[model samples]
Target chain A: MDISSGVTETTIKSKKTVKKQKITKGNMTPYLFILPSFILIVGFLFYPIGTVFYYSLQHYDVAAPFYNGFAGLDNFVTIFTQDKMFLPSLLNSLKWVVTEVGLQLIFGMILALLLNQTFKLRGMARAVAFIPWAISGVLASSMWSLIFNEHMGVLNDLLMKLGLINEPQAFLASTTTAFTSVILAELWRGIPFFAITLLASLQSIPVDLYEAAKVDGASRWKTFIYVILPQLKNTIVLTTLLRVVWEFNNVDLLFNLTGGGPAHSTTTLTMYIADLAVHGSNFGYGSALTVITFAILLLFAIVYLKLSRYEKE
Target chain B: MIFNNKKADKLITLYLPLSMMLCFTIFPLYWTINTAFKPEGDIIKRPLQYLPANPTIDNFVNAWTNIGFATFFKNSLIVGVATVIVVLICSTLSGYALARYQFKGKRGFMLMLLCTQFIPRAMMIIPLFIIFKNLGLISNPLSLIITYSAVEIPFTTILMSGFISGVPKELEEAAMMDGCTKLQSLRYVVFPLLLPGIVATGVFTFIYTWNEFLIALMLTNQQNKFTLPVGLASMMGEFNVNYGALAAGSVIALIPAILLFAYAQKHLVNGMGGAVKG
Candidate 1:
C-alpha cells in the first residue's frame, strides 16, 4: 500500500529483483571458499581415520610384510587378550591424564587469579608466565632434562647444598619417582595452558560481581566459592575436556625424556600405540590398537560431554 | 587502615608468590640459555656457577655446523611457513563463509569442526604414515606441510570465523554499495581489518608445525629431512646425548617461537577468548 503508486513501485521492484539475482549468484561463493579446507581435512584427517579402521581389519606390517591380509577381529582380539603392555599402558594413560589435568587446573587457576590482580609489572609478569606455553613439547622436554640430569642437574645441586639428601638420588631412575618426574615436567608446561585459558575467562567476569560480594561482606573464600566458581564452571568443564583429550594423545615428553623408561613404567597408551606404529612393524596390530584407541577416546568424549551436560542441566 | 592492609597484603600476596612462581617459570628457560653459552668443563662442575664464568658460543657453533641443526632449522622453517600459508588461506576463506553465509548444513559444518578437536593425534599417525608411504611422501617436506595444514585447519577456521564475525557485516556491504565486488571488499576492506586475527592464527599455526614432534618423527626417515624437534629428539635418544650441543640446539629452536609468541601474545589471548565464545 505504501509503494507510492506504479511509477515508484517499478524502480523498487527492479532493485529488489537485482538484489535477488546478486544473492543467487553469490550462493556458490561459500562452497567455493570452503573447497580447499574441505579437501585437506577430508583427505588428511577424515580419510586417515577411515583407513585406520580399514587397516585394522587387514593384516599389515611394514617390517614383517610376510603377515599381511584380512585380519577380521584378530588384531583387536590380541590387544585385549594377549598384549601385556595394553593393560599397564592403559593404566599409565589414566594416571598421566588424571594427575596432569588435575594439577594443571589447580595451579593454573591460582596463577590466573594471581596474574589477574591489579599490580605493577603485571604485563611483564603475564608475558613471562606464558612463555612456556609457547615452546614445543620437545623443547620443554629438553629444558627439563637438563635440570633433571643426576650428575649435572641444578636440582640435585640445590638439594645437596640445602642438605636435603645424603647423595644425588636419581629421581627419574626409580619406578616410584619416574612418573612423578614426568608429571612435574609436563605440569610446568601444562600449567600455562590452564593459566592462559582460565585467565581469559577470569578477565571476562564483571568486576561489579566482586564489588557486590565485597559490599555484602563475604570472606575471600566465600567470595570465590560463591562468585568465581559458578562463573568459571563452563570454561573449566570445556577446557578440562580439551586438556584431557590433548594430554591423552601427547607422547613426546615420555618418548624423549625416558623413552617410555627404565621398566616400561611411564608408557602411556599413546606412547604404546606410537611405539607399535614406529618400531613394532605390526601394522594390522598397530592399526587395531589405533582403532581401540579411537574407541576409548570416542567413549570418553561422549561420556564426558554427556556427564558435563547432564550436570549443567 | 585499608592502605596499611594493602601494603602488608601486597608483600605476602602479590610480591612474594609472584616472584616465586615467576622464578620457577623462568629458571628452566634461564638454565637452557645459560647452558647454551657455557663450555663443556663448566657445565658439570661440582660447585655450579649460577652464572657462566666462561661463556662461549662454541656450543652454538658446534650445534649449528657440526650437529646438523642448520639443516633441521631450514626444514622446520620450510614446513612451518608452508603450513601457515596454506592454513591461513584455507581457514580465512572458510571462516568468512561461516561468518557471513547461511548455507545448508552450516551447523553440521561447525559441528564437524568441533568434532575434529577430539580426533586422537596418536591414531592419526597410523593411517597418515600408511597414506604417506603409499604416496611416496614419507620423507618429503610435502607430507608434513599437507598434514600440518589439515591438522591446523579446523581450529584455525573456528578461530578465523570468530574473528570474521567480530567484523561488522555492514563494512563489507558498504564497500559493495560503493561498487566494489565482494572479492574486492574482502581483499581491500576486510583483509586490513582481519590482519591482526590472521597474524594471531598464523603465528599459532607456525609454532605448532615448528614444534610438533611425533608426526615429524614418524613421517621422515631420512636424517636430512628432520625438523628441529625430530632432530632434537634423535639427539636426546642418542647414547652420548651431548648436553652442551643439545642445549644449544634447543635454544636455537626456541628463538622464533618465543619471539613470535611475544609479539602476538595479546592477540593470541583475544583470539582464544573469541574462539571459545563463538
Candidate 2:
C-alpha cells in the first residue's frame, strides 16, 4: 500500500512540474505577440511626446541653430506675456468645452432616456441617430460651412425666405457668429457620442426597478428622479468628463470651418499651436504651447479624478 | 386604464427622441444631398430651394476629374487597409497578453497605454511631423499608416483585451493539454472565437485612418499624394469657393464611410456596445 501511494505521488509531482513549464511558455508567448505594438508605440507615440518636451525647453527653429541652448521657462513666460493670442485662445477653448460638452451631455441624456423606451423601430431610430457620429469631423465642418456660408449659405437663404432677416448673415465671417457656428457643428457631431454612450448605460438598467415603482403607484417623474437618475449618475458624470477632454482637444472642425476666423474669434489652443509650428514657423513656441496644453489637460484629469473620488465616498 | 397610460407614455417618449434625431441626423444629410444637386448659382440665391431646381451630374463629373479623386481613393484604401491590418495584429497579441497573463508591470503597462489615449494627438503633431520628415517617411503613405496604428493600438488593445478575457480560459487549457503550442492554441482555439471583435476593430481602424484629416493634411505635400480629406480641404481657398465641385467632392468622400458603416453596422454596434460596457 505504501509503495503504491509513493508511485502515485511521484507521477502527480511530475505532472505539476510539466503544467508549470507549459504555463510559463504560454505566458511568454503573449509578450512576443505584443512586441510589434510596443515597438510602434515607442517609435511613434512615446518618442514624439518626448521630443515635444525636449523642444519645449529649447529655442529651436527651422532655419536657426537646430538644437539651441536651453531657454528654461522663457518660452512659457513669453507665451503668457508676449503671445497676444494665448489668453484669447485659452478663453475660446474654455467656451468650447463649456458649451459643446454641456449641451451634448444634456441633450444626449434626454434623448437616451427617450430612446430607452420599449418602442417599435427603436433599433432603426438609434442607428439613424448615430449617423452624425460616423461623419468625419472635417466633412461635418465643411457641410456646416456651406450651411453658414455668407453669400450662398442655406441658413441665410432660409432666414431671408421666411422674412426673419432681409440680409445675408455672415455667420462664419463674424466674430460672434463664427464661434457659435463652429460650436453648433461640433455639437451636431458630438451629441451622437453622448447619445450612444448614455443609451448603452440606460439599457443596462433593469426594468424591474420601474415595475417596482409602478407597483408602489409612483408617478413617471418621481420614478425617474428617484430611480433612473441614481442609476445613471455614474455614467452621466464620466461621459461629461470624457466629452470635456475631447472638446477641449478637438481642432479639425474649428480649423477647417473658420480657420480661427474673421479676426481670430474661434482660434483654439490647438489652432494656435499649429499656426505657430506649421504656418508661423516657430517650432519652439509651438512646442511650448503643446507642453502648456498637456499640463492643462493633466490638471483637468486630476480634477476629474478628485471628483470621481468624491462621488465614490 | 394602466395599459393606456403606459402606451401613451411610450409614444411620448418615442416622439421626442425620434424628432430630435431626425432634426440632428437626417437634416444635415438631406441638406448636403439637396445642395449637391442644386445649380452652383442657385445655391446662394434667395428663397432657398428645399429641392434642387436644375439637378446636374456635372458637379460630380467635374469634381471627379478636378480633385483627382480616383487616385485619392486608391491612396486612402491602401493606408486604411494597412492601418487596419497592423492595428488588428498588434492589438490582438497585446490584448491577449493583458487578458491571460499575470506578468510583472502588466498593470503599469496597461495604465501607460490608457494614458496615451488621453494625450491629445495635436500636442504631438509637430514632433511627429519633424520625426517623419527626418525619417523620409512624410511622402510615403506608410507614414500615415504608422501614425494611425500607433494612435489606435491602445483603444483596440483595451477593447480586444476585454473580449479575450471573456473567453473561457478552460478552453485554452484544454487545447494546451491536447499538445498544442501556445501560438497554436491562440491561433486555432482563441482566435476563431475572437472573429467578431477582430472585425469590429478592423472596421473602426479603417474608418479612423480613412477619415483622418489633420495629420494627412500636414504630411502629404504633393497633390497626387493627397488623401480624400486633404484633397477636399485644398479646394477651399481664401476668396473663391467652388461650391459645386467642393460639394461634389465632399459627397464622393462620404460614400466610402457610408458604405463601410452600412456593411459593418452590426459589428460596429456590437463593438461600441462592448466598449461602453468595458
Best by TM-score: 1
For residue A307, give model 1's deviation from the true position in Å: 1.6
Report the C-alpha displacement of residue B90, candidate 2, in angstroms.
Answer: 0.5
What fraction of the true Cα-Cα contacts (under 8 Å, chains A to B) does candidate 2 also have? 0.54
Candidate 1: tens digits of C-alpha lDDT, residues A113-190: 899999988999999999999988999999999998887788888889999987886777879878988999999999
Sequence-dependent TM-score of model 2:
0.93
Best by DockQ: 1
Off by over 4 Å in 2: A1-19, A63-68, B1-11, B176-184
Identify the candidate with maximal lDDT: 1
- Quality of candidate 1's docking, in CAPRI categories? high
Tens digits of lDDT, candidate 2, A1-313: 9999999999999999978976867766766877898899888999999999988888887767765678888899999889899999999889889999988988877777776776778777777777777788878876887788877788887788789997988888887678888888888888778878777777778989989999999998899899888887777776777677777878878778888877999898888886666566667778989999999998998898798879779
Across B1-278, the per-residue lDDT of candidate 2 in tens digits comes to 76698678766677855786668677777777788888778887766788899898877887787658778888889999999999998998899888977776788788888789678878877898899899898868989999999999999999999889988998988998999986799899998998877887888888898788878877888888888878777776536878877777788888888877766665654566567566
RMSD of 1: 2.3
